[model samples]
Target: MMKILVVDDDPNILELVNIHLSQAGYTVMKALNGFEALKLVEEDFPDLAVVDVMMPGMDGFTLTKKLRTEADIPVLLLTAKGELEDKEKGFLAGSDDYVVKPFEPKELLFRIHAILRRYDKAVDLFIQAGPMNINRQSYEVSVGKKVLLLPLKEFELLSVLASKPNYVFTREILIERVWGYDYEGDEQTLNVHIKRLRDKLEKLTAEVIISTVRGVGYKLEVSSS
Candidate 1:
């Protein structure tokens, strides 16, 4: 079971997060403040942390910064401060994501799941190709700091192809690797995904795009455009 730590000064919020997370089948731990949360980390690291920004001692920003500097753990900052500056500071402090106060529990749950999925799959959690940075754990693909939205299959396809730049992957190999050989879909499905991935990459002004080799498969290349 995955362990999740929830840090908040408000008893009600802590309770709510704990109940929902527990029901979601995670081992949920609670800390009323950042200090307690850090102490807990010393004993056993949680898979991910949902931290409130305001606390009596060791605010979430400080705690997040410390964790990022030392442990590379993922953090989601939950706070009422929704200003652009506040969000920027959270990112600068090493927060992986930020949620404002009074957020829908389901939204929180989804975000948590995405972040955890990224980390649980890959310990390094990030892949880079040209100007693109794909964060496997965060489910994020970015050019520099700007994140690009991608559909699930498209994202997976991009990851596979970008994992080895300029290396041709046969259609049979791609389907077997990405959709699985057992995938009952048409072989044409791979082409559709490739087209969409190419369009999205172009829209993002990515320096790389998928290049198809006639009678063969495809590879990602650094484009001059």
Candidate 2:
């Protein structure tokens, strides 16, 4: 499911978006200010964030700019400011879209869809396997409270395995899926990548294990106990 973070000082707006967005089948999290939102980003990486432009400590513009340096997730600014200059400044601050206050919820959703179409990955932008949360769009994976910075190939390999937990992926299948059909590397290549991936994953949690099926491929298995 695509997770969305709603950052607004107004409790009413937060509740409204939570109720409506959650009803729309999206996981919703809220923060009354930008600091909380930033902390949540480290905890749970959302596919998109709806931020209000005016707040106490960190306004939406500043927050959006800060987020740009943090993650690749899309940011949509919600504010009463409708001036073209303000919109330009918002865009300059790295907001994907701006929704003026008193806007229709349907319109908000529509705008969100437009942003997703432009910025998000495939429809399934997120994946959860055991304690690991993966965001395809942001290319971010969090294992429990720790956010891992994995290399490209390692990230893709983990994403492939995590997509279907405990399902054995044959060596050939893993190569085809992760490295592509015309991969010039041999099975040894897969082994090397798996070792690196295992090292990183183990650093996060030893409870999460990647098992190698002899003569087959690999499967991600996590302990329940």
Candidate 3:
């Protein structure tokens, strides 16, 4: 069972999250403040943390930075302040995702599952092709001096192809892996994303190319030069 630490100043919020998470088959731990949460982590680290952004002493931003820098734990910031600045601050503080306080239970659960899925996908969690490095955890691709941040879907698509260089992935398999089984989009969607990726790669380096396999699908090829 995966352990999740939920930190919130309000007992009501803590209880609410605990109940929902527990019901979802996760071993849930609760803390009232950031200090307490950090202390708990010292004893037992969890797979992920759902943290509130408006605590008394250590605010959610500070707590998030601590959790990310010290424990390297993935965090989902839960708070009522649904402002653009707050969201930007959350991301800048190294939060993996953010959720407003009035968020749906199902949506919260889905986001938690998604974060855990990304966390569990790879051990190394990055692919290095020549000067380009595709980091799945950070969702950023760096080529030499330039770091490119692609959209989530584009990043996932690139990661999947780069995971196995020169190995052909058909459109069906790529769509299923990147967009999930229930992706209800036309085939043109994949083509658009692939074209975008190729355009970005062209700007980065000539050593790496996303090759088309004639009528099949796409493959990422890194030149040995």
Candidate 4:
């Protein structure tokens, strides 16, 4: 069974979430604070984490930031603060999704399942194209002799394209697959991410690998050289 860690200081909230998650057939781990959450992460990494933004010590933002540094575990931030800035902060802290307080249990379950599904689909079995090598298990991508450290989204995007080299994928399709249906962001977000990926890949080879199809989408160039 997939394991999920839920971090919240509210006893009632913890118990309620635990019951719902259990019903959904997940192994749930509970932590009342960030310290405990960190410990739980160190001991055993969960498939995903549900974190409350407001806590006594070490708020959700800090914990999420710390977690992102070590693992790419999907994080869903549950918070009473519904301000736009608060949501932005959660995203900046590496949360994969955010949910406000007083949310329905059914909605929460759906979000959890969706995030897991998206994460699972983001990576392929493996990708070997040209001089590049990708290991889905370790989430590593290398170019020729050099190992490149790519951000999670960038790596996933490349993996998707490289999985089927030369296949053109529309920007909308790429955004939906990479960012999830629940993603509430502008299309410019995808553009920026693609640019970042291009910058990183350019360091490895002078020739560009990702090609824009102009008003259609993008595809990995099948090098003739």
Candidate 5:
């Protein structure tokens, strides 16, 4: 059974999530705060985590940062504040997805399943774009004969875009495809990842392989080089 760790200060929220997740056939674990969440993570690694943004002693943002350094476990942030900046903060902190408060239990379950699907698909061994090669199994990328180490998200984002060259994918599409439909990060997250990808590719060729369409989205150019 897939294990999910849910961290929230509110008892009602935790119980509600536990009930839904349990019914969906997931083994649910609960933590009332970030400290307890961290302890739980150390004692027993979970397949995913759902964390509330506001908590006593170490907020969700800090917890996410700490978790990212040690593991690639998919994290979904829950926040009462539905501001764009809050979402951006969660993304920057290394959350894989987010959900605002006042959300339905069914919606949360769907988001959890979506995130798991994305994570599973991301494990596919390899993807190639022109001379560039990405080995998902090893989490390594190379161009021609040169090896390039990329951050986790950068690799996933590039792989998703390159997997379908010449297709323009909007920010929302990329987020859903690469980060999962539960992802609530701002479009700026995509821009940051794109910039990183471009910088890495610059080492291989002067020609830009990924092109951005104004008011549309981004696409990978079918390169003849």
Candidate 6:
């Protein structure tokens, strides 16, 4: 079973998360602070960590940075504040995902599963496009705590574009990459997928934009701000 470390100052939150994670078949390690969390890491490395932002000594951001730089561990940040700035700070601190307080237990479980799946491979099979996070392994696209379930074709199309943001990919190349060379579909098929992706992205997140380069093809652009 994969090991997961849960860090939060509150005993109630810690136990809540622990029970859920344990029932989900993960080996749970609990910590009340960053110092204790790091000590646990030193003794036994975990596959991932679920950290709360507000703590007495070292905050979640600092601890996340330490886990990322020191051990290269993936973190899912939990915070009561749902402001955009706080979310950005968590990402900047190298968190794999972010969940706000009063979140549904199912949502937390889903994000954890997605993060773990992304890390299961040798090479990182995840894409971070500003506020949007795409998991190639799980076919899940998340913007903050909102997870978007996409069709296989749409997910593959989005993944290809996100793999190289701002790089224009010709229609033929995209078709081949996503649908395979054996695909008998024409350019209209690609156009349909592009349209669907554009609609979804426009509705879901402004951070990631799918732009059509008239003559060339489509390019995915990620907002830095």
**lDDT minimum window of 10 residues, candidate 6:** 116-125
Give per-residue CA lDDT, model 4, range 84-138, as digits (tens).
Answer: 9999999999998988899988678778878988888323467788878889778
What TM-score does prediction 2 earn?
0.56
- Enumerate clash totals for all models, in the order shown: 1, 0, 0, 0, 0, 0
lDDT of 1 by residue, 181-216 (tens): 457888799999999998888887658989998998
lDDT of 5 by residue, 62-88 (tens): 888877778777899999998999999
Q: What residue runs in model 6 are displaced by over 4 Å at the alpha carbon?
A: 121-225
Give the clashing pairs for model 2.
none
Q: Encode model 6's per-residue lDDT on 1-225: one tens digit a residue.
A: 468899999999999998766544467999999999999999999999999999999999999999999999999999999999999999999999999998876678778877976877222478877788888778799998899999998998888787667777778667755776567967998999999999989888887999989987888898866
Model 4, backbone clash pairs (residues 3+ apart or across chains), number: 0
Location of the lowest summed lDDT over 10 successive residues in candidate 5: 121-130
RMSD of each: 14.5, 12.6, 11.8, 12.7, 13.2, 17.2
Candidate 2 off by > 4 Å = 125-225
Q: Score residue 22 of candidate 4 by CA lDDT.
A: 63
What local lDDT does model 2 show for residue 55?
Answer: 98
Instruction: Tell me the TM-score of model 1.
Output: 0.54
Score candidate 3 by TM-score against the native: 0.55
Poorly placed runs, candidate 4 (over 4 Å): 121-225
Please report the candidate that would top TM-score against the real structure.
Answer: 2
Would you estimate the TM-scores of all the predictions? 0.54, 0.56, 0.55, 0.54, 0.54, 0.54
